[model samples]
Target chain A: QQPVQSPQAVILREGEDAVINCSSSKALYSVHWYRQKHGEAPVFLMILLKGGEQKGHDKISASFNEKKQQSSLYLTASQLSYSGTYFCGTYQGAQKLVFGQGTRLTINP
Target chain B: IAGITQAPTSQILAAGRRMTLRCTQDMRHNAMYWYRQDLGLGLRLIHYSNTAGTTGKGEVPDGYSVSRANTDDFPLTLASAVPSQTSVYFCASSDSWGRSLHFGNGTRLTVT
Candidate 1:
């Protein structure tokens, strides 16, 4: 099943913080995050497999909750380069991945 | 280093015509996938192959077909074009199971 993403769109200024959430109705084995700029391919940011694990680098981080079948991506101290469309992909059985509708993040100076 | 390459950066097809989107990966990943992205609806899986010689239907496989004859290439064919088929198609591959994917730049196809 396709995961549901919250905050269809968000606007923020430089140095602000934002959180994008994705949740599924069925059980999930893994959650993947990707960011895509207009007219470009999606670039993978990270993937979380463990229920209670959190991972990230630089100013981005993510939290996965296996029990609730939910994942949240955190963006701190946002920069102008951070403006893009964020997608959350939920890995299903047999290596199938379904992506959410996406959240458009706009960061201004 | 071309991780993944998709042919015909953009194309325009007439209805009822057959067209194929080409994809090749140099990473030698065992898994390959085809997804189509549309405005507002996001990316939808069209087809996938776990390994060479095996293919499976994805969430939105209707009207589209894919073949994985080898590890380096996965091609998607549309038997008959329809206006609704107009979208940006992306090719992606991963090492296996849940590995991170390497995506192609994508092919923008317009069906008229």
Candidate 2:
């Protein structure tokens, strides 16, 4: 089944912070985060594996709570380039990686 | 500059026509996936292939089929297209089981 994402949309100014959450009903083997700018393909951000440590890239970071089957993406000091639709894909067993409904984030100066 | 490439950037097809979307990656990833994105539905997995000569059904694979002929190409086929199949289709490749997925620009397919 597809995972659920919170805060369907969010708008913020530069230097602000935002959090997007993703939760699944079933056990997750790993969680993958991606960002897609308008009219472009989704770009890989980071991946959090079960029993693995939380990881981050530059100003964007993520945490995975294996017990709750939830993951959260954090964007601190958001920049204009951070404006895009964020998607979280859950990797359960059965060779499937299902994506969430997506969270649209906009940042302005 | 090596990455995934999708053909027929955008296409408009009539219902009942057979259509196939092309995808190729030069990274030689072991896995490839097909996903359809609607306005509100995000991206839904339509089909996937773990390796060449192997295929698997995804969540929404009823109207779609896939073939992994080689390590670099994985194409999605719709035997009988329908209006419901209209969406932006993306082709992604992953080196690991479900790790980093590099996506193509996507093909906007409209069936009417």
Candidate 3:
């Protein structure tokens, strides 16, 4: 099943912080975060495996809670380049990865 | 490396026509996937292959078929295209089923 993402859309000023959350009804083995610009393919951001692991890349970070069946993406001091549609993909004992509805994030100067 | 490459960046086809979207990966990943992206829907998995010569249906596999003859290629075919099949198709590859994926530029297909 597809995961659920909170805050369908968010607008933030440069240097501001934002959080995007993804929750699944089933147990997830891993959570993958991606960012897609307009008219472009999704770009891998980071992947958080089970065991309550947290990963980060530059100013972007994510946390996966196995028990909660949830993952959250954190953008610290957001930049204009961070504007894009963010999607969270979940893997749950299947060969396929299910993606969420996505959260449109706009970072303005 | 090219990572992943999708052919025919964009194409328009008539209803009931047969079309195939070609995908190739140079990363030699063990797993590959095909997904369709619509306006509101983020990305829906259509088909996937865990390794060469093996394939599986995903959440939205209807009206689509895929074959993995080798490790470097996976092609998605629409036997009879329909209007609903119009969307941006993306091919991705991963080291394993649960690993981060590397996506292709995508093929924009339109069916009228």
Candidate 4:
């Protein structure tokens, strides 16, 4: 099943912060975050594994809650380059990954 | 480094025509996947291969077929193209199921 994402769209200032959430009905062993620019493919950002702690890259961070079966992406001090469609792909012992509808984020100067 | 590559970056096909989207990965991953993305919709799985000879249907596999003849290649074929299949197709490979996957640039297919 496809995961659900909240805040279909979000607008942020250069120094603002935003959070995007992803949830799945089925138990998820891992959640992968990706960002896609216009007319381009989705690029892998980070992955949260089962029974593991959260991880981050630069100003981008994520948390995975196994009990809630959800993951959240945090964009701190958002930059203009952060503008893109963010997608969270969920995996649960399946050969294919299921992506969310995506959250369109636009960061302005 | 050549991670993953896809042929015919974009294509225009007539309805009812046969088309094949080729995908190749040099990472030697054990799992490969094909997905289609439509405007304002999430990426839907078309087909996937756990190994060289194993294939499985995905969320939206009715209009497509896939084959993993070797570890480095997983190609998707459309026996009969339709307007509904007009979308961006992406190929991905992972070391194992439920692991992080690397994606290709994607092929944009237009069915007229």
Candidate 5:
């Protein structure tokens, strides 16, 4: 099943922080995050594995909670470069990755 | 590395016509997938190949088909296009058991 993402849209100012949450009803073996700009392709950001783990890159980070079947993405000191649609892809035991609806984030200067 | 390339970036087709979207990956990845992106609907998987000569259906596979003749190429085909099939299609290749998915610039198709 496809994961669900919260806060369909969000607007933030520079130096602010925001969190995007994704949840699944079934157990998730892994979570992958990507960001897409308007009229462009989605770019991979990070991946979080199961068993309660976390991964970070630059000013972004994410945590995976296996028991809750949820994952959250954290963006610190938001920049205009961060403006884009964020999607969380869930991975079950299967080899395929299913994507969520996505949260559109706009960071203001 | 020219990680992935998709041909005919955008196309317009008439109903009941056939069209093919070409995708190629240089990473030598064994798994390739096809997905369609629509507003408010996110990305829907249409088909995937675990390796050469093997294919499987995904969430939304009614109007699409794919084949993995080799490790580097996976093409998506629409036999008899319909208006409802108009959307941006993405081609992706992955390794590491779905750990990360590398996507190509999508092809926007308009079926009239």
Candidate 6:
């Protein structure tokens, strides 16, 4: 099933912090976080498995809660390059991934 | 090496015409997927293949067909193109099911 993302859109100052949440109705096997800038392909940021493991990329970090079937992405000291659409993809025992509606994040100077 | 390559980076087709978007991966991944991205709709999976010669429908498979005759290629076809199908199509692959995916640049298709 497709996950639900919170705060469909957000605007932050260059140094501000933000958190994006992804929640699924079905049990999840893994959760992936991707960011897509205009006119570019979606790039993989990180993946969180169902065992409470966490991963980070630069100033971005993510946490997965297996029991709640939810995950959260944290972006600290946002930069202008962070402006883009963020998607959370969820996998539930299948070969295919279901992606969320996406969160459009804008970081301004 | 090209992780994944999608042909006709962009295309414009007549509403009733047939079109095919080609995708190839050199990573030797065991799984491949096709997805369409529309404004405000995020990315919706159209079809997927776990291995060569095996294909399965995804969330939005209507009006689209896919075949995986080999591990390196997966092409999506539209029998009769519709305006609603105009969007950016992405092809991705992973070593196995539920693994991290690597995506191609994408094909921007417009059904006029």
Local distance difference test values of all predictions, in order: 0.93, 0.92, 0.93, 0.90, 0.91, 0.93
What does the lDDT read for residue B45 in candidate 4? 84
Docking class of 3: high
Q: Could you tell which candidate, 1 or 5, scores higher by TM-score?
A: 1
Candidate 3 lDDT, tens digit per residue, B40-83?
A: 88899999999999999898999999999999999999999999
Model 5, position B84: C-alpha lDDT score:
96
iRMS of each prediction in angstroms? 0.8, 1.1, 1.0, 1.3, 1.0, 1.0
TM-score-wise, the better of 1 and 2 is 1
- Per-residue CA lDDT of model 4 for A47-86, tens digit only, reads 9987746899999999998788999999999999999999
Q: Which is the winner by DockQ between candidate 1 and candidate 4?
A: 1
Candidate 5 residue lDDT tens string, A1-109: 7899998999999999999999999988788999999988899999888778888999999999989999999999999999999999986446577899999999989
Model 6 misplacement above 4 A: none
All candidates: TM-score of chain A: 0.97, 0.96, 0.97, 0.96, 0.95, 0.96
Clashes of 4: 0
The TM-score of candidate 6 is: 0.97
lDDT of 3 at A64: 93
TM-score of 3: 0.97
> In model 3, which regions exceed 4 Å deviation?
none
Q: Give the chain B TM-score for each candidate.
A: 0.97, 0.96, 0.97, 0.96, 0.97, 0.97
Ten residues in sequence with the least summed lDDT for candidate 1 chain B:
B94-103
Per-residue accuracy of model 1 over B1-112 as CA lDDT, tens digit each: 5799999999999999999999999998999999999999888999999999999988899999999889999999999999999999999999886568889999999999
DockQ of each: 0.84, 0.80, 0.85, 0.79, 0.75, 0.84
Task: Give the least accurate 10-residue stretch of model 1 chain A, judged by summed lDDT.
Answer: A89-98
Query: What is the Cα-based lDDT of residue B108 in candidate 5?
Result: 94
